[model samples]
Target: MNLLDIEHLRVDLRSRERRGAPRTVIHDVSLTIAPGEAVGVVGESGSGKSMTVKAVMRLLPRRATVGGTLEFRGTSIPAMPGRDLARFRSQLVSMIYQDPRAHINPLRTIGDFLIEGVVASGQMNRAEALEAACTLLRDVGVNDPQRRLSQYPHQLSGGLLQRMMIVMALLPSPELVLADEPTTALDVTVQSEVMAILTEQIRERSVGLLFITHDLDLAAAVTDSLAVMHAGTVVERGPSADIYAAPRHPYTAALLASRPSPTSVARPVSIPGRPVSAFEAGEGCAFASRCPYAIGQCRTERPEPRTAGTRTVACHRSDELEAVLAEGVRA
Candidate 1:
């Protein structure tokens, strides 16, 4: 079953500059996550991947204007009442943010921070929740859980704090987990360990996960499926293995080619031209300026998403591009 559904979701934020028109940071993006499945949304910085998930959690700023059908377990999220929204936020859905330090309260003890949601939601008494928190901390590989709980956020390293955040997210047994670049700030070794723990726990519980990140290889390694985004739109989406083997969209191919490999000594292949902001994109293809295969039509008309084999791609030249990419892979 689908745990989360989004269709034609658009979000416009008030411009940072006074007197400027609202800028549409997210435009007509759609995605779905099935129970027990992990889907990664991969994109460059400022590509709206984070904003899209933020919209799913209803965590966008008040100045943001949002339009879309966001459903969780067949229930409309935007239309939920205050009590339902609170329950959803606290119990049904949990988020692992990018920075653990920013999310936790420095004044509160680690134990208090970990158990607050369970206590507030009335799911467990304070003592019971505290016990559960300790168990989770141990499960996430933290040594001396009891001692760690007594300390403050400032006392722990970045990796340990992130693991704590992961434990906290799973404490509620949430049906859906939205992880926004949960390992971006950690070292490579710690990043891998944290990701492994997260993937294992979420799979054990059969919970849905929406992982957002800019690293295509990392996304492919951790997720079952991927949605490649550019300028607030999903340019391509498919099974992780297939997309990594042969991407159908130019943007997806470019991202894959940009990854560094020890066997290659050549300079990394970079996608030409900077990505356009949503407001800066014109009527035509948003990636036309950077796509080496762009034709006149690409500069004049937007391409709607079309199914190609087992995947979907939003590019007018997808068929031709797929052949080229596949041939290159074989070579």
Candidate 2:
């Protein structure tokens, strides 16, 4: 079953002005996830990656005007009202947001955090909630669960705080977990552990995961599918290996090249030119200015996303570029 289906997911953060103008944030973006599937949304900061999910979760502030079909478990999420919204967020779908320190309350104990944070939202009682919280901590690989329960957020390390948030999200046993950079600010070792715990927990519980992050490498490590967002648009998406091995879009290719490689003797190649914002698009392709393969057609008319051979590309000259890359590799 399709757990979540988001199409033409446009989110404009600006309100209809008291005068007459309006601004925008995210443009048309689409994606789907099957039950228990883990899909990663990757992009630079302010790319509308977070905003898009925020729209779906209905977590965006009142000023935003959103237009799109967000279906969760065959039901339209955007159309949900009153209790349905609350019910869906708590019992069906959950979000683990970025920044654990800021998220956690210094005044609250871990048990209090779990209740006010996760357990209190649903049907679990205080005793059951406490047990559930302990189990969740253990499940997320935090040792000495009982002792940790008495500790505040300030007492925990960065990695432990992150693990706590993940546990709380999973305690609800939600069908879909939208984790917004769940492993951020942790060391590489702790990052790996968090990923392992999350993947395992999601799989074991048969929960679909929407893992959002700026780290393409970490996303590749944890997800089966990759969706690359640039300046509020998904410029490229494909199977993780396929996209990593051969990114069809210039933005995707540039992102891959920007990462350091052990085999490389020099610093990583940087992708020149900044990405276009939601309200700031030129006449042609969004990536044309930065695309090395762009031609005159690219500068005049925007290209819709299309499948070329094996991968999808939104460039006017993608076929030629693909051929050139293929031939160069062969040589």
Residue 290, model 2: lDDT of 80
Off by over 4 Å in 2: 15-17, 117-119, 307-311, 325-331
Cα displacement (angstroms), candidate 2, residue 1, comes to 2.8
- Deviation in angstroms for 268 in model 1? 1.7
lDDT of 2 by residue, 155-225 (tens): 98888888888887887778899999888777878888877888889889889999899999888878888
User: Per-model C-alpha lDDT, please?
Assistant: 0.89, 0.80
Report the Cα lDDT for residue 29, model 2: 76
Q: Model 2 reaches what TM-score against the true structure?
A: 0.92
Clashes of 1: 0
Checking candidate 2 for backbone clashes, the offending pairs are: none
Q: Candidate 1: which stretches are off by over 4 Å?
A: 16-19, 329-331
RMSD of each: 1.4, 2.2
Clashing pairs in 1: none
